[model samples]
Target chain A: MTRARLGLGLLGLTAAALAAGCQDVGGTVALGVRDEAVYAREVHAVLEARCGTLDCHGDARRPLRIYAETGLRLRDELRGQPLTAEELGDNLRAIEAIDPGAAAEDHLLVRKPLAVAAGGQRHLGGELWATRTAAAPTCLVAFLGGRDDAAMADACAAARAEVSLPPP
Target chain B: MSRRTLAQVATLALAALLAAGCLGETPEEQAARALGPDTCGGGRRRGEDDDEGGPEHRCGQPCLFCHSASYNPGEKIFIMAGTVFTRPGDTVGVGGAEVALEDAAGHQVSVLTNSTGNFMLSRGSSLQQRGKGQVRVPFDLVYPVSVVVRKDGVERKMRSHIQREASCAVCHAAALSATSAGHVVLEGP
Candidate 1:
């Protein structure tokens, strides 16, 4: 074979590879599978801001404590690393509670405040966040759905307008 | 991606495959999902509808784990219960002490300790000041509330947020030393 023919064949292979590797705006390379890295960056902070109030998940006794230390444990888990036995159990239970395919509809998000308008009952914690899509409830919805941060921020900001922080 | 030359792209595919394998769901996560905890003290316990199981089933603290502590179905839990003593090491319960919970909405729910130094928060009694004879709009499901304990007209306020810490003994345990006996105790006159 000639040098030109070999170069032409290589170019064809590269083209096919590029087409297969095309990705969406977010960093996801494929459909399905939850992205823990995005969750750690965008959704985790939102949880800390909204859920980590005094007398709530901040306490050790609550079912889902959202203390800063817990965030560390979550970060480790997101990286696909090992968790302490205690952290593993807690995280697994939490993961089980969530529906990765339908994160917004998860009991965790739906049971929060602002869910009433979204066809969900009023949260005793008073609606931490909301969205037009019930199955895709909060700003974390966008992040969970593989949307960019800009989209998540916009969604959460809208939900925040309707949200009233419980009295101090 | 534009910065990648032909040589880089060829190598990139192989790197991506290797990285994906390393960062994918781990065996520990799978084990945790499958086997769960081996002991009662393993991890957080799921709330039980009826109080029949041992510590493993009821180990969740703050009382919400086993009881529907909230007025709203959204909270899906119940109020707190614990015995308060006159002093850290005393065996005697402090009766007639005023236990009030102030929520973020400025609503106050107060109850007196029974003879056993036990008190339970009631939805009927909450929203006393601003509820206007209606179910309080914002319920105290998992939000933060300030717990104020008063006796002899003197008040002791807990400024930290205590979401579902229904069982005070979870933090306040009996010990012989200052550091060891970390229990919530009211001062004696």
Candidate 2:
């Protein structure tokens, strides 16, 4: 009986070890994992959802088109090369500050305001900004999550303000 | 076990521990460490009022606009131009596009695409170069033009392939688009 109990205990330990090994460390926070390929995807999604829409950055009518597919086609129309550490850091800081705890940063909530205040044209819509404050952490958080929402009211408002658009 | 065997087991255990440590922390942890923790408490608060102007103008609204460009002191300004083609009568707005210029060192200068499918960056500016003017720049810079177009209520985004002036010349050498004024056209399908 003693030997059997010891064997059983050893088996349990092995099982526990195996389970621990199978557990995922990256889980949800995996979004923050900054692989070049993954970074490309994350940045692309964030730019598209937050920056690309309406006549802001989304409108082909605008100059300096920054669209979803910008990552693949960055060699043609712009000078220099891919994003640098500093630029990415700047973008991340802008987005992260507004919607802390989100996987991706919402540039609309934070960056847009700073840009507009600094005399930069607003690339986001006005509606987005108006509703942004109300939506609270979710809108900001979602932006940081790099998730796309069909109705980005807050972002729209903030963007509109950045461009000095009239109130709706 | 013998002394040699004991030492070998210890070494093996140390190697395993090292491997486990490496596998323990993920890229996100590293990025968070690099970026720092979030102290903002993951909630929205209203403080400042965002008052810019009246409602945003729709497509075809005439307005004066400026393209973003950088003027680095020690580099020539490489202007990238492109075109966005649309239906003859359809009024579509261009905005929320990603524009970028990258150097060989992965240093990128970027600006959002505006409502006219135009983005520009003036590298080697006097301000960037501490009041230096006209410096020799390399052609190694890559210019990327991309934009999102919104018609009615739907949004469509497009990005051009990474091609330099030299590469573009391989096809449109004779009818090459002008670099001045950052003119690049996007023809819709």
Candidate 3:
């Protein structure tokens, strides 16, 4: 019951937690869940730029449909309008519909459109990222996998930087 | 003339002017014109080669208005239709251009603009254009489509996806500022 023993025990617990929290960045899939704040900020832009083109997931008929400012909007309106909060909610619901209350990485939401070498299946969208090591899919996977905030931000930022909406 | 006669004559003249104005512009046309009134210049007059009659009619106008017009407005629900113009102020349509479209389902369809720079894809659409005349099309368009206008090896790809607005003119109206990004301009030679 000494102060030294208590301090040592706390340190040991902290170390174990940190290691457990580390994302398994290789082939191994992480246990996943959707994050609203991260999705609204970072993840949605990645999807909009890569997958949300009209000939792709931007279509409402598609199961994992996406809406973007530079891609598709849910309704007919001005072009320069930014993505609305309601539209973001609609997109989140579309992702939620894939496998309600389940991990996203285990589902097609994360698998399809991913590189074959990156453990993704060839879907209608084909391969978005050539490998899982790429920033976009990595960011998406890490966010879906419920990785730490710092990890998610880094991955997402890197992914966002590489993509931009094509000029109209 | 007496004061009463003069007043009566003035009233009749004012009434004729208002009536003529109403007869000239329909409600929808007025609404459409109001959307972007200045792009085509004030008190615009039709040019000699302006879009009129057949599929080539109504250039720089909200095309889908034909869908609900009282007369023989349109045969089918034209899902995708627009006029490609060389400049914002240019009323003449850019003909011989290729309009490429791809839907969410990975289906791609391409059509060429006739002399009037008009192209359309409708649901169960049978009417089409061959050269400067009308023909039939076997294909149908799926909604939420993306478009690209190509001419002279130049590609003007649309930056956003269309989510069920049948006419590009709905967003790109007579007034360039009022419309989405102006009327699908393909500037330069």
Task: Give lDDT for model 3.
Answer: 0.66
Q: TM-score each candidate.
A: 0.37, 0.23, 0.47
Q: Worst 10-residue stretch by lDDT in candidate 1 chain A?
A: A74-83
* Model 1 stretches with alpha carbons more than 4 Å out: A1-93, A103-114, A121-137, A147-168, B1-81, B85-98, B103-106, B110-117, B120-189
Candidate achieving higher TM-score, 1 or 3: 3
* Candidate 3: tens digits of C-alpha lDDT, residues A1-168: 999999999999999999988957555323224666768887887777667755467666777877777545666663457778878887877877765555646656677868787788877555666777788877877766666578778988998877644654
Q: Among these predicted structures, which one has the highest lDDT?
A: 3
lDDT of 2 by residue, B1-189 (tens): 899999999999999999999888565344323422211111222122321211121122211111113322213233443222233323332444443444334555444444543333344423131111112223335323233444345444433323223212122111212121122223332
Per-residue lDDT value at B144 in model 1: 56
| Per-chain TM-score of candidate 1, chain B | 0.47
Per-residue accuracy of model 1 over A71-159 as CA lDDT, tens digit each? 22333233213224454344334533444344544444444545566655665556644555532255655655557667677666654
Rank by TM-score, descending? 3, 1, 2
Interface RMSD of each: 12.6, 14.6, 7.3
Which wins on DockQ, candidate 1 or candidate 2?
A: 1
Share of reference contacts found in each model: 0.15, 0.04, 0.16
- Which number leads on TM-score? 3
Q: Where is model 2 chain B poorest over a 10-residue stretch in terms of lDDT? A: B59-68
Tens-digit lDDT track of model 2 for A57-98: 433344334433222122344322444544344344433443
Residue B100 accuracy (lDDT) in model 3 = 84
Per-prediction TM-score of chain B? Answer: 0.47, 0.28, 0.63
